[model samples]
Target: MGADTVYVGYVGAGAITFGAPNVLWNHSERIEAILRTRLAVPVIVDPNEARFKEIMEQKGNGDYADSYKETKWFSSPQEAAMGLDNETKDKIDFWILAAPPHFRGTTIEGRDLELEMIKLFGNKANYFVEKPIATTRSDEPHKVAPQLAENKAVVGIGYMMRYLKVVQKVMSIIKENNLRVMMVTGRYACAYKECHKTPWWMKSQQGGPIIEQATHFCDLMRYIGGDVDMDSVQATTLEHTEPAGEIGVINVDEQAIPPEDRIPRATAAFWKFDSGALGSLTHIVGLHGIRYSNEISVYADGYQFRINDVYTTPVLHVRTPADDSKEQVFSYPEDDMFHNEFYAFLSSAIKKAGKPPLPTEDLLSTEFLSDFADASKTFELTWRIRDISDAHADKLLAQKAASSKKASA
Candidate 1:
């Protein structure tokens, strides 16, 4: 690839979503950032005809849409791959695999695109893939990890929360003070009634909320407190039938979904980190309206860091022994974490391709954070929590059944 231009191949468009009125979500923000880059020319590749038509119809609706008006479009991954191979193999610098989780393992034509990219371009196969690598317990990513290691593919997993300025400040403080993290706690609460009535409601499809939504916090917990001791993980959840008011009911029609396929209304999980630090995460869907409350706190020996309002104006509160334990607050009202994540990946791609470095300093030193193997670990953690919580729910059901049998006898 030349230093003057970067040609990118983007896999999916369904990840783009709207939050508030005329306000794009984080995924959309990422696409906007990529499109706005001076030297990047991206092409959209998707197999869904309906989605393609929908995006075309809505192309003039927002700034993000307007930026991609003249972009190329492909109907399938194979078509895009062939076109790149034939025309711009040397110029193809990076790929954005933003497809749905289920499609990540194998596309519509049963192709492992990530592995194919490695085989086709080797080390030049840089990618920015989305989270929860796979929806189901697929071994494709596990199989591809060794090849990624061999080819040294520059891959960046989409855990954008780590790029927040507040988060960076926390990391700097920890590094400067040589703080040994003692505990990390994260809470994610949102309104269930306001959730979109999509396939996300089906646990079998979306892998439940913990895997789909709360995975962000899980990754952050691992980032702050070292790797987790997977065997020490434990969890419990509030089932839909537990009680009326305990778990908020979805306003969407769910009669088609069977009882077993329904997701938990609330889940609480805790784990022991390899660093001897304890971590806990709670996700509750009982709030009202579209407002969401998300926060995380890290506790060290003599220092405490608490981050609040992650979705809106992020604020970091610090308490240290040197300050007489008085709270010091710092606010970042206009931080674009999604943009930061995109720019980091692009800069790394350019550097790895031997092109002249961009003016912006590289924010991440490593090839990538949350690579395929690391993302697989986070994926395993979420499934482990779901499995344990399901077991707890099963025990409760069995005990209730035994009591009913004894009373009838």
Candidate 2:
């Protein structure tokens, strides 16, 4: 495999799951599959390649390895990076960090590799990080930015939906119409906390729905509604059944929590963005993913784009252009969204330039929006203003200042 194209090296378990945690998950696999067809050689798979091999050994479940049977494997991602050093004669186009589990936040385990990859191969290759870039918004990681810049990190938070063709069209419409997003409505349902197969509902440490799953919707909120100004946020937690005592992994401490009383439900609020766009997001693991599909609708300029089961193709929706009620259609072109997303990250890496030529305003906006979920007994908002030249920064700042005054008034 030469460096003509980016190679994917998926690590961890969730990626190993059957269908998808999200539609783009499957879409990414399909795009990679398509690329494999058009390319001279088959694409590669690193750590995930071995994990599936192990699973097929004992459980006889082919689900994990089936799609990626011919795929390559590396000992660890770093080892894979090293292998590629020789594998491609050091002409790697870019590397994909599709690791899961860190969805909640970075772990103490193998923490060294994260930074080491930045320091050692920092410039050796460019890479892409899946969305929710880190376990949480830990500024501590940016301390390593110089090394990251040296490494030529053309990294992206894989917020595939923002780049969806229709979504982009919506953005174009907004800019074309000079529309301002006023509100967004979203809903999701899953089985009760007791029925969680992956135990994601147990606690945020385990990555309960909102941060782990609903993050895409959060990003879309910003994407469709423009920026947000989170004024205040509140949440209510539920603990009807504490840890129905299931024996577990290193992260699961069944002993500390009694089998009968594990708290699993929480409704949250986020009222804080300089943009002052109010947002409402909710999630419940008590319902089945099959029983409920994702919903997103934006209200702005007396126009709305209603999308149902938005994750997959045929994004269901009713659109309005000022006067007309709305036009509903099916099988709209969303695959292009995934296609653009793929090229955006790869091109950024190849060109060695600014944020993916497509800087997902959606992802950047949600980066702070979800922190509204974690309440600290105090109404809170957090921010870290980046250093930038004054040329146009002041104008954006002045607009926010005027907007804030109007919002307060």
Top of the candidates by TM-score? 1
How would you encode candidate 2's per-residue C-alpha lDDT over 296-374 as one tens digit per residue? Answer: 7766766776777666553645466635755755445525555566555554554552322322433122121112112
Q: Where does candidate 1 stray beyond 4 Å?
A: 15-23, 26-37, 48-71, 85-87, 106-111, 138-140, 244-249, 361-367
Each prediction's TM-score versus the true structure: 0.87, 0.63
Best by lDDT: 1
**Alpha-carbon lDDT of model 1:** 0.73
Task: Name the runs in model 2 displaced over 4 angstroms.
Answer: 1-29, 33-73, 77-89, 102-109, 112-114, 136-152, 191-198, 226-231, 237-272, 286-289, 313-321, 324-340, 347-409
- The lDDT of each candidate is 0.73, 0.47
lDDT of 1 by residue, 212-324 (tens): 88988899889889889989999998877678425445776666788777788888999999988999999987888878899999999988899998877789999998895
- The weakest ten consecutive residues by lDDT in model 2 span 377-386
Residue 153's lDDT in candidate 1: 75
Clashes of 2: 24
